[model samples]
Target: MKLSHKLYPFQNSDPTRKSLGDIIILHGLFGSSKNWVTVARFLSNFGSVYTVDQRNHGDSPHSEEHSIRLMSEDLEEFIFDHKIQNPVLLGHSMGGLVAMYFDLTHPGILKKLIIQDIAPRSYPFAYDKEIQSMSFALDGFTSRTEIDSEMAKYVTDSFIRQFLQMSLDRNEDGTYRWKLNVDGLNHARRVFDDVFTFEKTSETPTLFLLGGESEYIRDSDFGVMDHFFKNNHKIKIAGGGHYIHFTHQTEYLEILNQELSFHS
Candidate 1:
């Protein structure tokens, strides 16, 4: 229940009006609500937008337990506490998996769902080397520059390194640390080996935005996807990678508005 969030409200000239349904935007693993600043700003023109930091990420309290089921249940609690009625759930990667689980388990709560760059199938992940590199880069860091220098040795992409650095938090004592719960995350990753299965269908309208340059979703995966989703739209953003919302914001938003029909 230590989830931190930011609420972006739509601009109303009339000063006495409210928008339509609320939008709950969930970020991927090692991500926070800050990543969706642009998306939330744009979406706020249509409705109230709430961007949350999932457990073990951002400002959310670190937890020893992390999984799709746990995160989804946390989401349900957030919905109940906030008293948001049938809000749209928009998530990317790990967040997307959480959204799928939440919608399926709590049948009548979701208004619409937008999952970006993730499928319902089990994704092949090999994180040992990356985790090692991360530990090495994060250890004994006095400044962000020091961490950047260390991370540069392993992560070649400048953008990705910078993005990863966002998860780093500096202590009042000038020491740096990661906001992610690496131990819990490793456990959650192992659980994903036996990902959730959809034995039944639901009518919740869902839109899946795919990264054309990413291989997360395969043609074969759509069979099981179609079986579970009764009303859904699958879109591919050309030249976009895993973080399509950041890599290709303009096109991503355009497709989102068109597919989800969120317009002001």
Candidate 2:
């Protein structure tokens, strides 16, 4: 259960000044620790910040299999390895799902949980199209510009396509490939499709932030959310999409600061 992690520390000065609670950020599937750099830096003002790359992504070791339970165990070992306590858990998309599972299974390690734009219920979303596009680009890209041109056909958003293309790497032989564990992710598709399920018992304070335009979190999910998170508050940011933290960093940071102050 030796899980790898990357630690980034910063200064914080609250009245208590007693380690204003560490913040652990988790990225989504196909994403790496790099995704949380901006937000993590901002949160560092409130406490020490740690952004983890799940097993199959970034510098972390890759595995053929992936599961919420296994990811939770990895996180447990990570927290213990780093001796982190009362961490403010912030996770995006798939990362949020894993965070929810971790907080439910190991309630004592985390003080507060922040779930962004994802519900615990199973979602019908499909990443097949994107995966196919990535694979196509990986098959062979004469140059980065070629990959970008191909991706444009499937991905309309120039920014998102550019962000995704960052995962593509060129080898010494000039072959293009992806840094992600694509095969493992494709085979474990069910795990990605399955919605997170857990009984409501833990009384940990949780915040659910959803993007107003994102379909991931909707009014229908509120009933179950109310049941699962006894001490919970749900907020939606207008004009925000699934990637709210990135799309609206300043706004999201302001809300996060308010949340920290409430607990401070």
Candidate 3:
């Protein structure tokens, strides 16, 4: 599958400046490349930044099948198709899981790996309510407010409701429809809770960015992280939650730039 992407070319035009190679960013579930526009623009100063929409999300083609392995394969194809070399692969939440799987299966393909706010272990929580909300909204709403109202019943967080609303697409008749493949994602809900396992530890340099307010990465998960990534570094954003990049943009970017500079 050829994933859809938005590229931000290097901003600096000075010939004397050095290139930091490619930086590929993958968005989380129900997210599109648009979510990372600000980050991509900032990272563009270092290298060409490619914000990709994983399968079933954003402008990417939909599939009945969705899993970490399949998404990893899609990333592989996207990387090869665009001839991206030694890209600094970065992923957030669900996308981070895909990045880890890709590194585990196809080792040495990336310059460095960055996993944001997600651990290698399975999540206990399910997205049933969120899926239901999306399904209800897909029936077509007269206005974005009505959609938000309907989503609020399932998703309590205003920020998350607003985030999910970003995936809305207005139809010809002016009714709003979701851009994501809702049914496909609903079917694969269990996959999200599936644990990631590997026989051999990966040597690729990895950085794990944790959110202090988020329960996604627990203290116990550090052992799993160490077992998988032998050359891994962990950093925590004190005030950030699961969406650290959005909540702590300045701090997140500063840490990301510092880490990327180490390899550059």
Candidate 4:
């Protein structure tokens, strides 16, 4: 499947500056390329950045099947189709799983791998309320405020509600509808409970950016991470939550820049 993507070309004023190759960023569930526009623009100084929307999300073609394997395959196809050479791949949340699966299945295809706020282990189902709320919202709302109020019943976090709001689109008739494939995603929710098995370790240099306040990547998962990623380093952004890039943009960008510079 050809994924929908937006590219930010390197735009450094210095003519003497060399290109830093390609940087591909994958957003999390219910997220589109639009979520990474700020980060993409910032990374554009170093390399061309491509923010891609995985299947069943954004403007990408929706499929009944949605899993880490399929998404990784989509990423591989996108890379090959675009002729991206050893690009630096960054994945957040659900996207992180896709990146890990891709590297594990097709090692060395990526120059560097960055996994944000997710571990390889299976996670407990935590999106039931969110999915239910999204399903309700899909019926169409008169206003964004009304839909936000409905979502707030299930999701108390204002930040999460705002993030989910990005998936909404206003119809031509003025009704608000979810742009995401809600039914498809609902059917594929089982994928979240699936674990990534690692029979062999990947040699690709990887950076795991964890959030200090997030439970996604806990110390308990460090052993599994070490077994899977042989050439890996981890950094925790203090007080940052699952959405570290948004909650701690300065620290996140600083760490990303330093890591990419070192790898380059």
Measured by lDDT, the strongest candidate is: 4
How well is each residue in 1-264 modelled by candidate 4, as lDDT tens digits? 999999999888778877779999999988999899889998998899999999999989999999888999999999999999999999999999899889999977889999999998887657887787788834546888988898889889888889888988898889787778888888886786665754867999999999998978777888888989999989999898899998899999999989877755
Q: What local lDDT does model 1 show for residue 88?
A: 84
lDDT of 1: 0.80
Provide the TM-score for each candidate, comma-separated: 0.91, 0.91, 0.95, 0.96
List the candidate 3 regions with Cα displacement exceeding 4 Å.
13-15, 137-140, 193-195
> How would you encode candidate 1's per-residue C-alpha lDDT over 180-229 as one tens digit per residue?
77666766666455557657566898888899978677788677667777
- Residue 257 deviation, candidate 3, in Å? 1.5
lDDT of 2 by residue, 75-174 (tens): 9888887888788999888898889888777766679999999877776538776676676636656888888888777777787777676667788898
**Candidate 1: misplaced stretches above 4 Å?**
12-18, 137-140, 260-264
Q: State the TM-score for model 1.
A: 0.91
The lowest-lDDT stretch of 10 consecutive residues in candidate 1 is 124-133
**In order, what is each prediction's RMSD in angstroms?**
2.2, 2.2, 1.5, 1.4
Pairs clashing within candidate 1: none
Q: Which candidate would rank higher by lDDT, 1 or 3?
A: 3
Candidate 4 local distance difference test against the native: 0.88
Clashes of each: 0, 1, 0, 0
